[model samples]
Target: MAKISAAEVNKLRKATGAGMMDCKKALVEAEGDFDSAIEILRKKGQKVAAKRADRDSSEGAAIAVVNADANKGVVISLNCETDFVAKNDDFVALANDFAQLALNCTSKEELLAADYKGITVEEKL
Candidate 1:
């Protein structure tokens, strides 16, 4: 097996916001290949999302943003499984970011299709 460095694990953790151990395990499973490790982590997130599909996402934050020109406005909601998660500062900030992204789009389809950081907004969900 290839050696996994702490730097590589930290890089993955920073990029994905996954737990440290989860990032390490992904790196180990990918045999130290960075991109493969990222893919593994993304797949794991997909599994978690699938498992949470039945969850009730009744708690969330709503945010609105106006374009620089002030002619267009958009509102977005980010839902979570629990009230604690909904109230988290990070969660609110993320919702605001989504709203900002939405301000530039014409339709819900376009907003979901928008690129966020690296992946599509839908993928981020």
Candidate 2:
């Protein structure tokens, strides 16, 4: 087995906003390969999403942001299945990030189609 260092796990955590243990597990599963580790995490996410696809996600963080001029702004809701997930600091941060990105979009379709971390925002949803 490849020796996975704390630094590698930390790097994946920084890049993916995943928990330390999740990152470490992904790193170990991918045999310490960075890209493969990320892919592994992504697939895990897909599996989770598929499993919970039927669940209602009414709990969420509503984020609003304005541009530097205060003239342009966007409001977005990032939803999850539980209050625990919705209340998570990381989840709120992700919502804020999406609202900030929406500031650049001209329409809902544009926002949905926008690229987020190599995939569309709709895909992220």
Candidate 3:
């Protein structure tokens, strides 16, 4: 197997928001192929999501915001499997960011399809 460089792992981490170890493992498993590494990371996320699909996610945060015009309002909710994760500062900030993104959305589909940073809001979540 080819050696996985730290730079490569960091690049993958930035693109996928995956952990350092995960990015490194994916890169190793993909033999340093960036696209393949991304797919592997995505599959890992999907697997985790499927496994947790039936789990109770009653813990999280909700944020409501009004546009600068004061005419449009949006509410966003982010749910997590654990109260600890829900209470995390990053998690709360993410919920707030979603609320701001929601201001531009006319429907749930639009919100999901909208871009947050460079990726779709759905992908971000």
Give each prediction's root-mean-square deviation over alpha carbons. 1.4, 2.7, 1.8
lDDT tens digits, residues 54-122, model 1? 988999998887888888887798999899999999889889989988887889999999999899999
Instruction: After the best TM-score superposition of candidate 1, give how far the Cα of residue 56 lies from its true spot, in angstroms.
Output: 0.4
Order of the predicted models by lDDT, top scorer first: 1, 3, 2
Q: TM-score for each prediction?
A: 0.91, 0.75, 0.86
The candidates, ranked best first by TM-score, are 1, 3, 2
- Per-model C-alpha lDDT, please? 0.91, 0.89, 0.90
List, residue by residue over 4-75, the lDDT tens digit for candidate 3.
Answer: 999999999998889999999999999999999998998899888888889889999989999999999988
How would you encode candidate 2's per-residue C-alpha lDDT over 9-119 as one tens digit per residue? 999999877789999999988999999998888888889889999989899999888999999988898888899999899889879878988999999999899998898
Candidate 1 versus truth, CA RMSD in Å, comes to 1.4
**Clash count in backbone of candidate 3:** 0
Q: Cα RMSD for candidate 3?
A: 1.8
Clash pairs detected, candidate 3: none
